[model samples]
Target: MSTYSYRIVNVFTQGDDPFSGNPLCVFESAESLDTPRMQALARQFNLSETTFMLPSTRANARVRIFTPSYEMPFAGHPTLGTAHVCRALGLAGDTLTLEMQAGLIPVYATQRRWTLQASANGPSG
Candidate 1:
């Protein structure tokens, strides 16, 4: 028997309203979980998106994004929200570069808000 840690956060939320933002589930230190397990966990959470934090040799962290139904190479809200969680967990610094299947996504954080860069390819991430 084993257990993993996770956190729930609100992404792109309006001030002071818990229901205003897109809810995200971030699985911390998820290097042990495989794709199928991650997908199942995402389905169990049933949020718009869920993210898994993995150790990265090239970037600050490697992020895997999943919906209830499938995996995603990259996503916007999940990226930002996951970055916030990474910083909070000491897994990354204030500015983070996340390695994803699509590409490297950079995120900058302030005390209150976090922002992600739009890749030259487009805004899909």
Candidate 2:
């Protein structure tokens, strides 16, 4: 038998209404899941994106973002959403730095909203 837990949140919403924003599924402490399982979970959720939280030696947490079809190194919505989840779960403070494949990204939050400092990836061919 096996068990995994997740939380559903709507990011970038207009207000307190849950349905106003993009829905995301976040898995906490997903260190045990391998790539295939993570992909499967993301597909199962069928949301715009899904995030898996993992342990990080360099940042507050390492996050893996995935869509139903593929994985993304860094994404705006997931980054902000994950940071919000981290704060809510007490894994982070008002500010959070997430380690993604692109690099370490910082996020700051207030009572009303969250902000992320994302570096430009440059033009993609």
Candidate 3:
């Protein structure tokens, strides 16, 4: 068996409530994981959404979002949550871009708070 590092975070929280907002699980590195493994990991986490981090040629990093049942091209909370993890890992600065299935997303962070710029046309697939 192989070991992987992951972080769980709450997005869109108000004040200091740790339990508030949506819960998300982000895998620090998914260089070795395939689609099946990623799907299984998402199922194992059993959260609304789980994300994996990968190397990117178009942006600071690449992100893949998955639910227990399916993969999503893009998602708001997941994008922000993943961006937060990216910043924590020093993969990118306060302002960075995440390449997603939908398209490229630009994220900005201030401390623990994170935000993403959505595509005007929205996700494609």
Prediction-by-prediction clash tally: 0, 0, 0
Model 2, span 1-125: residue lDDT tens:
77898889888888567788888899988989999999999999899899999999988999999999999988889988899889988988998789987888888998758998864662121
Candidate 1, lDDT over the whole model: 0.89
| Candidate 2 wrongly placed segments (more than 4 Å) | 122-125
Q: Report RMSD (Å) for each prediction in the order shown.
A: 2.1, 2.9, 1.7
Model 1 residue 14 lDDT? 95
lDDT of each candidate versus the true structure: 0.89, 0.88, 0.92
Tens digit of per-residue lDDT, candidate 3, span 1-125: 89999999999887888889999999999999999999999999999999999999999999999999999999999999999888889888899999999988988988787777875788432
Better of 1 and 3 by TM-score: 3
| Per-residue error (Å), model 2, residue 112 | 3.4
Q: Is candidate 1 or candidate 3 better by lDDT?
A: 3
Best by TM-score: 3
**lDDT of candidate 3 at residue 42, scale 0 to 100:** 99
Instruction: Please give the distance, in angstroms, between residue 37's alpha carbon in candidate 1 and its true position after superposition.
Output: 0.5
When 2 and 3 are scored with lDDT, the better candidate is 3
TM-score of each: 0.91, 0.92, 0.94
